[model samples]
Target: MEPILALLTAKDTKEALAAFKELEANCLAEPIYADTLESFLPALTAENSCGRGRAFKFFAINARWDSQAVIEKHLTDILGILDDSKAPTLRQCIPYLTYLAEAKPELIPIICEKLDSLALDQYKESMQSLIRRDIEKVLSEFNC
Candidate 1:
């Protein structure tokens, strides 16, 4: 495994976060990191919340660099994270929709449909507003 990708599975939280930041920088600076997308996909469903969040960020950053349309091929699995039981994961996934939208504008309606289907009341009162805000921000971006 690549050093940065290897760090993503580190036992230490800080180490994983550092690896994510480094990966994010690389993805943002060039399309070279797109080859590693498959490796990060499993992290999306990792038991750890931070792991899931980092995976979301990974996909979001690589959306533009996804020359093979790999992200689009896995679009259903990506959007399904909106139904994740954890509020924090939902919060993390929602904002990344904007990046996905920029990469595939045609998916906006489908994305908005998924966002509208979320059960905000199922989350804690404090989190409900934040999650709603995240969804609204994305929806408003495309005026959906």
Candidate 2:
């Protein structure tokens, strides 16, 4: 595994979380990490929700550098997290859609369509509103 991938999948260690905080800037400055996008996909579904959140952000970071279509190819798997049962996970994942929209405008329609179909009622009453806001905020970014 690559050192960066190791850091990202490292069980949400302090170092991992710190790296995740700077991931977008780091990836923008040194795009080599973006080349490893495919390797990070599995982490999106890792048992640890933190890892999943990191992977989602990783995808958002790489959306700008995905010349190889890795993100587009695996988009279904990435978006599948919307259906994740845990509200916290969905909360973590939703905002990244704006990054995807900004970086890959062509995908905005597909992303917006899927988000429109979300079943917010499935979540707890308190969380449903928050998640709806999250989704709405992202949708608003694209004027969807």
Candidate 3:
């Protein structure tokens, strides 16, 4: 985990976030572990696109455990990352945002707005999968 924190300031955030995700997986149930993650997540999230990739890693781990509070709190940050025309940031963020949105279903309306605003030609299948899976999860949750 120490190395992961270092990665936050690494020359590459993509690699750092990837490292953090690995650490989170191994330490999910630790008593103070989530708090450590909480601190890193906000700081990394506040960073620009270089930090966007890392932010998704935090969002993904929190979402996997149904951490609605974490997801809800960062909803706007996730959306802001998505709104960027920067492919590297978008590539790192959209899927994680999709998962985050699932944990906080009330965010769907804004997410849908973001989707509509996207230049679809810029979206590849992976990006499309994000939206599709989100729709399925939310609809299923509503029994629709």
* Top lDDT hit: 2
* Regions of model 1 farther than 4 Å from truth: 2-6, 9-12
lDDT of 1: 0.76
Q: How accurate is candidate 3 locally (lDDT)?
A: 0.56
Best by TM-score: 2
Q: What is the TM-score of each candidate against the true structure?
A: 0.85, 0.88, 0.56
**lDDT by residue (tens digit), candidate 2, 1-144:** 466666566685777777777766777666766666788877877787776777777888778888888989999988887877778978988888887887899999999999999888888899988988888888887888
| C-alpha RMSD of candidate 3 | 5.3
Tens-digit lDDT track for model 3 on 5-79?
555535565666567667656544443344444555554544455555665555555664644355557556656
What does the lDDT read for residue 43 in candidate 2? 81
* lDDT tens per residue, model 1, 34-68: 77677666766767666666667678878988877
- In model 2, the runs with Cα more than 4 Å from the true position are none
Give the lDDT of residue 117 in candidate 2: 93
Span of 10 residues, lowest total lDDT, candidate 1: 3-12
Which is better, 2 or 3, measured by lDDT?
2
Ranking by lDDT: 2, 1, 3
Question: Cα lDDT of all candidates, in order?
Answer: 0.76, 0.80, 0.56
TM-score of 2: 0.88
The alpha-carbon lDDT assigned to residue 28 of candidate 1 equals 79
